[model samples]
Target: MCCNENFEERNKGEKITTTLDLTEISGMNFFDPHVHMTSRTTDDYQAMADAGIVALIEPAFWLGQPRTGIDSFIDYYSSLIGWERFRSSQFGIKHYCTIGLNSREANNEKLAEQVMEILPSFIFKEGVVGIGEIGFDDQTAAEEKYYRLQLELAKEAGLPVQIHTPHRDKKKGTQRSMDIAIEHGLDPKMIIVDHNNEETVKEVLDRGFWAAFTIYPFTKMGNERMVEVVKQYGPERIMINSAADWGISDPLAIPKTAVLMKRSGISLADIELVTYRNAISAFAQSGQIDEHDFIKIKDIDQSQKFASNSILRGGQQPRIDKNSIIIS
Candidate 1:
């Protein structure tokens, strides 16, 4: 049973697939500070590495559906550090994670309490980078309580906080997310406020916090909009992410956005600051990242097979290089 059964299952059906052209965008390495790989497939990982995503961070977030027990949180956290990390390495991508009680799920007081008790155990573990993807989901009281608690945890551990502002009532939510972090004694520099739009970027930057924009499809800031953001606010402490998850999202959002910036006359220095340098600086707060680890992956054994694992089933072929010659 290979980890990826989706691609193999698809091959069994009589269907034709078209590959996206990524030839013009090769050789540039990226760090997608945010992604939910648990919701993506192995094929996505292989393509990401091929597209130059050398490392990524997976923050523990609420599932589309709520989790009911502490055991579920433990299992999820374990996978972020264990199976998920291992699987990423298999594709030559380094995986790191952040563990926390996401605001959306904090409404369940009982489970939240249990989750809080076990969080300390995971905080200092290997590959656990920050305390985050935590903050105002609905701006509710329960959300505030857990957000403060996690902020304290981050302060205690000296780890950075990755905040998720409310989708609705966004401006106020983004402001309040920063306010509450400050109220809890977290420095603005230690917080990475994610999913910022034009309405909220100025306030976030003025407050001295790191503003991270997600180049999502349709709904969130697209590359064009993000380029405008770079123009409005120079890329000092700004970063970009795909925040790509179970929804209709793109993992190549970071690089694609960088390309757009380049085409729009943004300098390579500015481009590097947002896409690579910013994320590296933010995650480096964990003191776990090594700058020397950015070298090209060598000797990737595409022909290698895993224990009871293969990228295919029923004698099908494995596409180690998905963007290339499929000599059929």
Candidate 2:
């Protein structure tokens, strides 16, 4: 009998069954190399912490709508490095960010020009990891112009880049995205080509770029397909992310994928590399990350404040019982 079958037979009369429990993957540290915490809430952070997510990098992307002025970009970038960082720390997860002009916003040439000027100011800030979420959205000339400019900025700043592949014509766009980065004379290892699928994965890995998969529900790559990708191609430069944002998405996708991958027979070591270590190794190029720091026990002190902002609300005290049934 199979291991699962044997276990089920042993517990025949009990309520136990062969179904895999997600908790089986607990206590394993995870680092989501790409996620948008600015669009998320405090509850997500707490859940991520509970799920073994040690650190995450939130790349700058379109905020579901276009902003009309340069000041909006400035304030948005400020919050990434300021309030967002503070909020994540309250939940004991380290938050790092990438600053860039997203492709959708880049089409506004008038505003894109001004936004480019200010990117330099935030790119080198503390906790800022790289230039990212900065590739083709609609594959327009304006998008290409800013994408190339940001690539140059990333090269100039000696930082890694996170490329967002176009959802439509993804295969062609993925190829072009790699070509441009190579044309700029940037090393493939320094670039992370994200939002990949079966068609784009082999080429990305073959080209020596870090291939990041966004496990989104009902769209993008699903968990079952992700397992097949791992089964076909061993985890080397491959990494998985939640890429959870303001839309309908699961913040715990990484941990949940870990569960599925485990059930699908992917080894623990391989799972760890794809879900955590690979992301750390890729972004550690920024020289900002210390893996040791993440491995330590990160204690959360709710009393801490940043710019007068706390995780608590309106003078409410911190709840001590996470499992309490009472809702106040």
Candidate 3:
């Protein structure tokens, strides 16, 4: 939380420390439109708040290991909209999620079919944002099949689509993701292309889709490059996210990058546009997000329980810190 503090983190489950300074962007709060809090911990929630993250979007994604049954999917989806929402609320962080059968998971045709049947049941729930983190992984035929199907679901439901472009051949995959969405008659405004890089940002922006960049420390899309992306493109429909998970990732990447962007001469308004406003604007189409909800913090009671479960443990006193957070 201080300048160049050695913050302990996990890199592929290995403990290590990454220096983070929330100094520059302390009072400037942000919104990470894509992060996997289910794969994170309470410590992360605390640090995120300290790092100025006020709201976030968790997209239902690949759980690393493949899930065999629909029950796992159901419970996982429910947790994001229920327990995760509750946990984030305890921290005064507004949480919203996108539900979908991921690209890799879509390859399991039988399970994918079952998932599609259950999608409608959860997509309309409270804190539910839209159909997302759902696009191409390997860009397989099966991935395409469900991708188109989910686009139809999003269109019919009048919700936004958060797309995950493939790790390999991302250009073709990103183009295809947009192409299919258009072919399905989805407006570009309703589609958010995530995990974007230098290669695909122009087309994504030029075509009118929200281009989201995920900032990581060592690889993928790092913060330095992100600053240049904003410098060249300007922050119109562009957004930034942490995309933090159980692996080697920084949960505070958005604010950390904000600090770097500020030092690199990006104006505060441009920084907020990419780090906050743009994300909310892209997803607000769902009617689930309200600026007033997380725009400012009020008192948060750790004693409050969701389904008789509080963040408190045995004999632990509930704290009414308006700026604290916890997740089990």
Candidate 4:
């Protein structure tokens, strides 16, 4: 029997289950390489912690619309370091962030320029592991300009970079993103060329850059395709992410994909490498990812306020166990 089936049978009794819930991954931990927890709810945080999400890396991304000012960028960066970090810790998850001028918003040359000046300040701050989710969106000149700038910031900080490849013209854009990072003298091993698919994975791996696949619901790669990439490429410098944000995304994408891979005959070591080990290795380059912080839950006071802002609509309890398996 496969690992998922074996674990499930041993834990849940010998019955074929059809759900894609967290019960399948009871004892395993996951590291979500990309997610926008700023837009997510406390319920999401509670669910993630319950699902064994020991750590996550949140990248500064473009909201559905463009941000207007530098103070907005400042506040956003502060939230990543301050509020978000505190919020995640309340549930026993280590929160890390990547600061950069994202590709879509890079089109606003004036605002992007101002944001660039402030990026260096935040990139080295605590909880920031890299300068990232920063690359081409439309493969435009402006996007390339800021992408190179952020690569320099990452290089200066001695940190790794998490690149966001263009959704359109992805192959050329992915290649160009890597080429520029190399041109800026950033080591290929220090860069993660994310959102890679079949067309781009070979070049990414061959160039010594890490290839990250986003296993989303309807766009980017799905779990089945991700499994194939791992099978063909053999999972050395490859990783998977949820990139779960303000859209239809799954925070459990990594663990769920790991479960699928196990059921499909991928080895446990291979599953662990892509879903967990690879991310920790890359993020550790920041010198801020503390293994001890992730090792144990800091004493969570269930009585304290959940977020500096409110986690409830009215005055709901902060400690709701969403995963209670009740069979009434």
Candidate 5:
């Protein structure tokens, strides 16, 4: 049977039920442009590697609750460039990150001031790709204050920007996000407007900013809708990401969406562009990414440790079974 074939068995005079298996699209390289790896596990890393994910970017985001101090932000940003980078590399995935004060957290006026003070120090770090996952959460004046500051920060650092559009009044927020970026004299081509939908995609693309869709299970963009988006947009500056985090989400959303795109008759080159290339081109403005280096799979030494932390525990050895049905 072909790998992409639906898994089903026929019964006399009965309808057959089938399940979509993601493994069908195995070996296709993917790069999740926006995900929260700090909220993921080692098993998630292994599954991503198995699905042929070559690289990913974990944007600094709210930690589900408000952090109390500027020192907390410092530690969190340190982990993104330190521990998280090492963890992803152990699974043969090159990890990159974007640092900024998330919009929700920006509402805290007291802490927001301190965060802005500390952001400049981290924004220029080695693994830092851009200033992002930044923009309006509730469209508050404080959020806008920090948002514009980070836009200036990106300009000073000569890095790209990632804008997080608001969930409520999305169309208005999406437009405002672009308007603000342009107002700051930042070029649209150097910005990535994320969490976009059908209503916002056209305007974002028309304005020349990259539009990134997050394919979540019950909310945001679904895989079926993504196929149609590709059909409508034709893949120029369009990209998809799992955006999986501590919430209810799937880490394999990129590869799974790629499978759905193929089943829907999207061409391989277009699939490659939206699922992988577009993200690289958008973020490579930081001059931190070299497509050739990241596209190649690095050697995985699961036994390797960073800061006294390894992917293994209890002296467990690494397992490499791609087809084994056994669950340990």
Candidate 6:
């Protein structure tokens, strides 16, 4: 998710209002290509699986606060490919991630240079689907400097690029992101423009980039608005995501939005296109993922460990009940 200067940290004790009938889209497969699971709990993983999400792509994003040193970025990126991947598998979801210097962090030139150095070591590593959620935050010179560098990285590596359009001046940011990618000699088909809205969809599609909408509760596009976008655009290279993070976001948003798409008379073929197929078609260009990647993930051996650490604690048992709603 992109940074919003107006947003404040909320108290976790506060109640989150959600739609009542999220189960209507059950039994369908979803690929939320922009969720931040590091900030969510095991309970959210269980809920996403219960909602029919077979796999997801967690892109590198701002973590809601400034990370002080290069070690922090290194540790965070390591978790995305290591413990976080293992954790999602324990709960029956295929987790893949994009590796890059995020827009916000790129503004810090010295730290950004250090991050750029470490990126080559990780971008070509396993489970890295693309170089992304990378684009303008405030559209500063430093952001553009590293943005171009990562674009070169993705092209030379033969991986796709996931673009994060800005929260403010979204239309202009979305347009400029595509222009720059094109100018860099990257194919439009290789770019995934995210956080899109009505103001930017047509141009994104016309330019041949995959248009992705974030189904956030208030600040971004909502489920109702998403349905109309599909109705008008007809789901050609268009997909939707939750973008759930350490904010007032919903992890079960794709399923919930599919329910609305069904009730609104959107066809099942169209629904599956936007919710699942489009995501696979886009990121699979990296030759890093395929049909077998997300196939039937369940009944994992929870006894597994990452770097001598287990997802399980002292008295907690491994989860075997897929039908149950709670993770633990």
**Total colliding residue pairs, candidate 2:** 0
Clashing pairs in 3: none
Lowest-sum lDDT 10-residue window in model 5: 1-10
Model 5 stretches astray by more than 4 angstroms:
1-20, 295-297, 300-317, 320-328
Cα RMSDs, all models: 6.5, 8.4, 6.2, 8.1, 7.3, 4.8
- Once fitted onto the true fold, the runs of candidate 6 whose alpha carbons sit more than 4 angstroms away are 1-19, 299-328
lDDT tens readout by residue for model 5, 1-328: 0012233532235665674477767768899999999999988998888787889999999988889998999999999999888888767788999999999999998999999999988888887899989999789999999999999999888999988888889999999999988999999989999999999999999999999999986668898999999998899999999889987788899999999899999999999999999999999989988766664436334333455766543233375674598867
Kindly list the per-residue Cα lDDT of model 4 for residues 206-302, writing each as its tens digit.
Answer: 9999889898876688899899889988979999998988876888888888889988899989988999889889888788887777865443343
C-alpha lDDT of candidate 1 relative to the true structure: 0.84
Q: What local distance difference test score does each model get?
A: 0.84, 0.88, 0.86, 0.83, 0.87, 0.88
Model 6 over residues 215-267: C-alpha lDDT tens digits? 99878998999999999999899999999999878998999899999999999
Backbone clashes counted, model 4: 0
lDDT of 2 at 266: 94
Off by over 4 Å in 3: 1-19, 295-297, 300-328
Q: Pick the candidate with the highest TM-score.
A: 6
State the lDDT of candidate 3 residue by residue for 1-328, as single tens digits: 0122345542246555676567877799899898999988777887787777888999999888899999999999999998888788767788999999999999999999999999999999977888988999888899999999999999999999999988789899999999999999999999999999999999999999999998865546989999999999999999998888766788888888888999999999999899999988889999998888784432344333345655543222334454467533
What value of lDDT does candidate 2 attain over all alpha carbons? 0.88
Steric clash pairs (candidate 2) = none
- lDDT for 113 in candidate 5 is 94
Q: Write the per-residue lDDT of candidate 2 for residues 1-328, one digit (tens) a residue.
A: 0012355666568675474346988789899988999888777888788888989999988888899999999999999999888777767788899899999999999999999999999999987888998999899999999999999999999999999999889999999999999999999999999999999999999999999999987668899999999999999999999999987687899999999999999999999999999998899998888876564325334333345656543222253555598777
Model 4 TM: 0.86
